[model samples]
Target: MCVQLQAKDLLEQPIWRTAELIKQSKRHVAAPDGYVSSFIDFIELHGGEIVTAASSCRVTSGFTDWRHLGQMGVDFGWGNPVTVLPLSTRRLLGSDEPCFFLPHSSVGEGKGDGGFKVLVLLSEAAMPGFKIEIDKFCSQEFGQL
Candidate 1:
């Protein structure tokens, strides 16, 4: 389930207040622990308009945290995964390309002070420009050396 909040509300509120808002949203969506066909019917009828409107928005956020599910620990004899990657967003529910928050491997490149990875999908044409912009930002923040 996804939650939506206004940018103004998020930015204007203090951390504690923002947390409270999140809690409120969660409580508002609380459902019984069982398959509810009514919920699906309700969303199918209403979600189309919301999804269409949100597609044109400047940004949309989604959470894909499954760390609590111990996704990283699963191994089919190949060994633990170094990273989990998300597929393209060609036919996803949300308008904007969804972002994924993945657990970083405790070893290798992901290790060091606390580190996590965010996977975003972008078009092939956008890659070069995005790479340049990211490189520029990294050079500025990490220094020219």
Candidate 2:
């Protein structure tokens, strides 16, 4: 969304369009274009640990698309989530799936940083860049590796 690339073009993109992309996603190694695991690696390097991770599609009962929750920002509330970015150094999912951290009604009341948690309805395309942004912030603010 930042550079104007459509969602489908980002998420469901065919590997043929970018040959190295397929090569990178293969089992033994990761390509430079890897978005998900890179974020996880960046996070762990910086000491920001993953608190929880799960697939919203499988573990959540959100009952709403959640995007509409963004409207709460008018009253100082975080709206809905649009997607999830998997952050795993392993470059794949096994029994444990991706964790979704999105805008929730109680962001500031939590135990550690005070931000609350909620799962949002989202597409896969939006996650890569999103992961980059959050990981970048963690590195900048907390001196994460």
Candidate 3:
């Protein structure tokens, strides 16, 4: 199921309503004229344009959310992963620097924190400014530095 939503609408609606909208918008994938077929047709029709746009765009970063994938609970003999990081050396979705939204570590100091962690791969040159923004956001949101 694919749901398309405008950013303005998403921001204005409460999370529960947004989730309901997404649920209601789901279409059966088994249909002959499903999203996959439409997507394939679209790609066939605009393949050149897509390639051109991808090549021309300078996408530096990408984001993926893996919060509820139960990665923290998987015991691999050595116990669950203390940290999870993407190992893509090459660009993914044209982004060299990727950010992953991960579940907090389930062991040690992070246990029971009830907060998520974001693993961001950024250039050394960009780190200072990024840290400042992150600190500012944390301070504003949590009333602490």
Candidate with more favorable, higher TM-score: 1 or 3: 1
Give the least accurate 10-residue stretch of model 1, judged by summed lDDT.
30-39
Provide the lDDT at 75 for model 2.
41
Q: Could you tell me which 10 consecutive residues in candidate 3 have the lowest summed lDDT?
A: 50-59
Number of the top-ranking candidate, with lDDT as the measure: 3
TM-score of candidate 3 relative to the true fold: 0.55
Clashing pairs in 3: none
Poorest 10 consecutive residues by lDDT, candidate 2: 89-98
TM-score of each: 0.59, 0.21, 0.55
CA shift of 22, model 2, Å? 44
C-alpha lDDT values of all predictions:
0.62, 0.42, 0.67
1-145: candidate 1 lDDT, tens digit per residue? 4456687877787889867766765665565642245557768888665443256566565556544457677898998776665555553546455566667766765463445676766667767987997789777857641
What TM-score would you give candidate 2 relative to the actual structure?
0.21
lDDT string for model 3 (1-145, tens) is 4344555787898999977865664554556787568767978998675222134445445556788887777897997788765676355444557678878766577585878877788878888999898888887856753
lDDT head-to-head 2 vs 3, winner? 3
